[model samples]
Target: MKQFCSIAEILELYEQYGNEFYSEEITQTSHALQCATLAQESGATDELVVAALLHDVGHLIDLAQHGSDTTAFESDAKHESIGAQSLAKLFSSGVTAPIALHVDAKRWLCATNLLYHDSLSRASAASLILQGGPMTSDEQLRFRSHPQSGFAVKLRNWDDNGKALEPPELNFKKFAPVLERVCLK
Candidate 1:
């Protein structure tokens, strides 16, 4: 597994690979910044903001593992699980749990909220097939019981809307302090 010993390491990874396209239009960095901005603007906790910032770090990790040949949009990397597990080393459940559950939250939302699936981006809708589509009733019940389900759902919403063509108002550097503050000491 890819290891990140410090916030600087994480930042460096972003600096190096974040320029890659997240969707067809948005770069990974832009997506991250936009998501974090949404979380912050929504008055989310520092941990949630941090989760939003780094929720897709797994994609970066997978890229690093597979090199440039990896087509991120072509397959399911289990990015949510990969990212959450990696981040759990340095952050509490407040952060990692939401990251871990975010994808399942997507499935849950698609199942529970009738309009949610229709609102998904084209790429997201396609990936939903690879992601097992919407959750079944039993799966939805278990997902709702997770302690971080609400936070994960909130993060999923930000993750969906974060794909903006314009530049983000804040950069990764702006989030460094929050990262440090929330890191396990």
Candidate 2:
């Protein structure tokens, strides 16, 4: 089975997907780079930064095939989960799990921490409910079971910022090297 996508291949996929679906202010590549930058600045592990960079790779596919609206998933096709599954065989759980659970981590925090749910993005606010709604009691029980709960929280926090209305300028070519750095063994 195919696991990792090469840098060139990933870029080709992005080209077909178009830039409009990523963010109005930044290209998909730029948004990813910003997330990676934030993760690195915060002293997260190298793997975490890589995960941050590629967390939304699945969005590329969704937009390519289904278009930009998260609502297109009908609340079931969590891009995070689809992305995680796609990357799982290529990377460690340390990387994939955060990408997968970042959304759920938000819900987990919202359910257990009173100060959080209110601050979610309009899209996230709605998507969170669709993704399981502020974590059921059972979900809370499971979130605490993870060893990297705190790391997932950080990833989620960075994810929120990655969708900035006016993110810093970034070039896709510059981060191209990162694709190789993370993907090849």
Candidate 3:
């Protein structure tokens, strides 16, 4: 796992790769800021809000190594896992677990809610298949058993809808305090 010693280094990582597009519509920064804004507006806790802001940091991290390419997107880069494990060094499960399970949340939704799959964007739809299509009945049961599953689903919703192009109300710099408060030494 990548260890982050300070919020500044994380911010620098964002600066370095945040401009890359996640798909046709959203750049990495836009996805992140939008997700964080959604969490804040929905009255999520400080941990969850920070989790939202940094959920896709792994994508940025991965892109830094490989540059933007379809292979990067197509591979099971397991970005959620990367982000979560890296963050686990600095945060509790309240934050890290949700990030880790967010991909599963999407799978859970696809299994339980038939209509949900229709709502995914083109890129998301493609990624969904790469993410294992949907959960099995057994998978659903085990997934729901996790305490953070609901929160992961919530974050997944934001992650799905967060690919908007408009300027966000709060940018990366605005989340610095929250990052500091939750960041472990």
Q: Indicate which candidate wins on lDDT.
A: 1
Taking all chains together, the TM-score of candidate 3 against the true structure is: 0.95
Q: For candidate 1, give the lDDT of residue 15.
A: 90
**Clashing residue pairs found in predicted model 3:** none
Query: What is the clash tally of candidate 1?
Result: 0
Ranking by lDDT: 1, 3, 2
The RMSD (Cα, Å) of candidate 2 is 2.7
User: What is the per-residue lDDT of model 1 for residues 1-185, given as tens digits with 9 covering 90 to 100?
Assistant: 76677888899999998988888898889999999999999999999999999999999898778865765467888988888888877899999999999889999999989899899999888888888999999999999999889999999999998988986466788899999999996
Tens digit of per-residue lDDT, candidate 2, span 66-114: 6666533355567787778777766678888888888778889899887
lDDT of 3 by residue, 1-185 (tens): 58666788889989888888877767888889999988989999999998899888888878877788743457788999988887776788998999999889999999999889888787777888888988999999999999999999999988887877775565689899999898876
The model with the greatest TM-score is: 1
**Model 2's TM-score against the true structure:** 0.84
TM-score of each: 0.96, 0.84, 0.95
Better of 1 and 2 by TM-score: 1
Residue 102, model 2, lDDT:
82
TM-score-superior candidate, 2 or 3: 3
* Whole-model lDDT values for every prediction: 0.89, 0.73, 0.85
Worst 10 residues of 3 by lDDT: 64-73
